[model samples]
Structures are given as structure tokens and as C-alpha cells.
Target: MSRGAILLLAAFSGCLAAAPEATAQTNTGTAIEAGGFVNPLLPSGPDPWIVRDGSTYYYMNTQGNRLAIRKTQDITRLADAPEITVWTPPAAGPNAQSIWAPELHRIHGKWYIYYTAAASGHDDDAHRGIFVLENAGRDPTRGKWTDRGQLKTEHTGIDGTTFVYSGKRYFAYSAYVGPDSELAIVAMANPWTLQGKETIIARPDRAWERQGGRQILEGPEFLRAPNGKLYLTYSGSACWSDDYAIGLLSAPAGSDPLDATAWTKTPDPVIAKSPEQDVYAPGHNGFFTTPGDRETWIVYHANPGPGMQCTPKRSPRIQRVEWDREGRPVFAKPAGSALALPRPAGAP
Candidate 1:
């Protein structure tokens, strides 16, 4: 790292103090009444995910014990969007509690939600894994969610996300591998089931990713570059650590996603904590575009201040993706929470 970059990272390594007012403000009654909006789209939301279907967007986040989704036509006004508690787990079962990182995706005209859950009585991270739910309705907020059981994997996993490349589909997730939680991918038999053996493509090999007292590479989200390059962005380090940031793993176009050697990890985090902007531990991200706008937007969660770590203090924030000559995504520093940014293009 450059001397300047090293200094910046050093500044964010500790828990700096911040006033509560520094947190992003929320506007409830007048949604999108202004031409711009501030960060922390909502007061608190972690492991945020959004999938656009038709003209509406369905948003989900980690809500322990149950799953809920927000329906919004204008994402800038997400605070005022209608939300439905889509599915609540039973009082006791394998997936009864510790609900986290729910992602809603539509495939074959049906809606599927993949999330992390564990046995109600278990406290070990070893017991935590990914599970799926299926809904056969046009509006996910108003449908019966059928439990599809846990996604079979050799290791415990979380932050499951699915994508299609060429003509086949694959499931990407974070699997617990010894001391490090690594990113893994597997072929899918259907929207809810993994078909083959899981392949560990990325690990917490860098110093930046070894923060939070544990090595972690979770929250796998995919993006296609302007060229044929493919990118898999994931959160590194523990969510409670100030060093938590995002890393990237890329593969050549048309390469087999199941082949572990095909993917390459970037040495530095593609995005990291912006202490200057009071954005701490910015990671666990997803992507979407506006109803008519083609510009890609990246959505994730972060703390407004230091020492907040892994609490409800983290909130959803977004910025447009930038690119370089090689078509690799370039992320600038996160915007200050209080500063107003143009409401996502074409919203409301």
C-alpha cells in the first residue's frame, strides 16, 4: 500500500469517537420530496439486499427470528416503503432463530429467498448455515413462503447469493473453512438446491481481511463488467471489526465458476471503511438499477461511527459503481452520512 493509503487505513484501525448526530437522518412523511437524500437510507439495516422485479423493488435485510421485505417503487424513499413480515420461523427448529442476510431472487417465474439460520438451541457458529424459501406469487410481500430446507454444503455457510452466467446458474456463499470463513461456489440443481460439490475460490489471505480477530470472506455478490470480466465482491473480516471492508474476486468471461483456479483475488479491498466520512465497517453489499435507469448502483450497510460494530447502528447506503480501463470496478471513498446525494437516477 502507498504511504498515504497506509496512513488512511491506520486511522480506521481503531475505534474513533463520533456524535450520534453524525448518523444519517431519516425522513418519513415526505418520501423523496427533495431532489436528493442523505446516506443511511434507513436508521438501521444490516446485510441489506435488493432485487428488482418488473417496476417494483423488493428489499430484504437480516431480521433475527423472522424475514421481512420492503416494497418500493422509489428506493430513495425506502424509509417510507411498505414492508411485510413475509415469514416468521417456528418457535423451535433447525431454522428457528439467528436469521441473517436474506436475499430475494426471482427465477423461473417464482420467488426464492435464501438466508442464514441455525438450530434454535445452538450458539456455535458451526451450527449456522444457509436455508431457502420459495414463493409462487408475483408480489413477494403477499404470498405463502414454503420452507425449502437447508442448502447442502460440506461446511457451514451464510450470506448465500445466486447468479447466472452463460446459460447455467450458480450459488455463491461464505463457508466456514477452519479459522477462516472463505467464499465458495457450487452449481444449482434448482433455485433452492445446490447440485454439485462446493469449491472454495477465495480466502482471507490478506492482512486487511484478517481484521475483527478472525479471517472472514463472506457475502458473495456478483457483477458483470462492461467487458466480459466477472466480479464476485464479498465482505472481509468480522462485521464487528472496524477493518471490515469489501474484497473482489474476478474471473475471465465464460470461465467455469466451479473451477477454483479460474478466479483471482485482489490484494487490497475494493472498498473499505471511510473513517473520514464516519462510515465504519462498510461491507455485505448487493446491487441493483433503477426502473428505467441503466446505471448500476451498489447497496450495503455501515456504521455511522466507530465502536458501533455489529449492532443495529449499521444502516443501508448506496453509491454508483465506477470502472477503469480494464473494466474492473473502482470504489471511491464512501460519502459522508449527512451529505445529500442525488436520489438514485430516475427514482420517484
Candidate 2:
């Protein structure tokens, strides 16, 4: 092995030592008689998105053929949470295949799910687009998710998410621009429609983003810091490779989100592969705060080893996120799969 590989191996071993009691077994497979839990809140899942409403935490993931959500009081027990199928595409329609990255949001007291899907028997770039579903009921898992139709965009896109800033709602998504995929922003007329032209905010220009021969930047999630600054976190590089990681972009709180010049990109990845921790390609993350906003946590998916190739083996994991003295978010190195972590605050 190369000298650098050897050094990383040593580092991985050291991280394991700090959490010697960590285990990779499913929640039921291991007995938890303590205050913390091990890595991989679930046995198998990918592109995980989680949100907290009231006392319940609702989790969703890319299930290939349909949309399913898991509800629980404690995120550590996600593996034991009750999952319900909320939406299924028609047998042969524009959104009948390749469902990916479903994000649930509550706007104006109604639930909205923005997701990506391709037509049946079609996986081409032209057939993929963003779609929306609405649920008017109080509880997302128990309500009827009505089809809201496809969200119009300039080209093929995926990983759509929305955020409201300065009294105006905006949408950010990853879309195809020629041979490459880049992050774009636009104004939203409502939860399901985009107005005006998209401004390409972030492109895969850095070395890490070009890894695995697929210059991709997708999965844009919004984060607002306590200092009143707006930050956009996205996954970079090819998901099919171990180099897949998370990158950041920030803008002033009052600035227009659709203005590309208003945002600045991080030179390197924030959350990435930690060889020492045995976690690879940790990206496609979502953030949620504990009840009363006492703590913040990042929920994402990663493989146990290199070359896992973006399969269901990429399981969901969570860890607490910290902030620097300047109020910027600080994501520590990815935690090893066996590392024990405290459950979210106020979790039962």
C-alpha cells in the first residue's frame, strides 16, 4: 500500500479506539441499555431526508419504486419506526420509474414533498424532472398525498428542495447544463412551481467535485445559521464512487437567493470519506434541530467501504453538528460505524 494509504489506515484505527463499544448491528440485533446508540440508525437506506414536526421525527429515503416515510419519537430507533408508503407513481407515466431524493416540507400548514422521477422504462436525462405531492392533513403519514404535477425547469434536474428567506420563497435544485450537472436557484410561485429563469449558483469546478469522471453537484439543502446567515449545502462528485462528499455555499440573509454572485462556495468538502472511520462517500445530507432548538444534527448516508457503488448498502447515519466561534457550521470528520452517539435532545 502507498504511504498515504497506510497513514489513513492508522487514523481509522485510532478513531475506533475512542468508541471501542460501537457496533454495526441493527437496533434489535444489539441490546441498548444505555444513553447512546451506534452508527447507522437504519440497517439499509440511501438519500435520507429527515424533518421534525411536533414531537415526531419523519424520515424519508429513495426506495426506487415508491415513496415511504418512517415516523418515530427517537431517531436512534429509526430502524424500529413504523414506515408507511405515502405515494406510488402510475404504472406508465412520466414519473413511473427511478424515484429519488424525496424531501418533505410543511408550508402554510400543508405538507409538500418535492422529488425526482423518470418516466416508466426510461432512465434518460430528458425524461427525469422534479415533481411535487401535497398532503392537506395534519399528519403527513396519515394523510392523502395528492399529486401536484411536475415542476417545470429548463432541463433535466433532481434533488429539489425549497427554503423561504426575506419573506420570499425560493427553490434550489441540481440540473443538467450540457454534459455536466450544476446547482441552480429560482423564485418559487408556490410549493410546486418555479417562476423566472434559473441562476446557476454552483458548478463542479473544484478537483474533488470532478472525481469519478462525473462532474456532478446535486442535493441542495438550505441551512440558516444563528447569526442570520444563509448557507446551502450540496453533495458533490459522482455518487457511484467513494469520493462523493458534501460542499457548502453561503449568502447573506437578506440577499436574493437567485443571485449567483450572492453566494460563495467552500473550497473543499465539509463532510467526506473518512478512511480511518470506515465510512465512505458520506453525502446527501439533511439537517434538523432538537426540540426547542437545543442541538443540531446532520442526517446522511454512506458506505462501509470503498467501491460500494451507490447501492442500498449506503445506510443512513446521524451525528451532531457544531458551530465555530464565527457562527459558521463545523462538521467534524465522519464518525465510524461503530461509534456510539447520544440520541437527539428531547427524544423519548
Best by lDDT: 2
State, as a TM-score between 0 and 1, how close model 1 is to the true structure: 0.89
Q: Give the residue spans of candidate 2 off by over 4 A.
A: 1-33
Error of 1 at 21 (Å): 23
Q: Residue-wise lDDT of candidate 2 within 1-348, one digit each (tens)?
A: 532222122111100011222332334324355566777888678889999898888999988778999988888889888789988889998999778889999899999998888887765677778999999998898879889999998877788999888788998888988868899988999998889998999899999998776788988999988898889999988787799999999888677888889999988888889898789998899999889888888999998888876778888989887776666887766776555565678978
Name every residue pair that clashes in candidate 1. none
Best by the TM-score measure: 2
TM-score of each: 0.89, 0.90
lDDT of 1 by residue, 13-62 (tens): 21112123232234422322457677888988888998888678888887
Model 1: which ten-residue window has the lowest total lDDT? 10-19
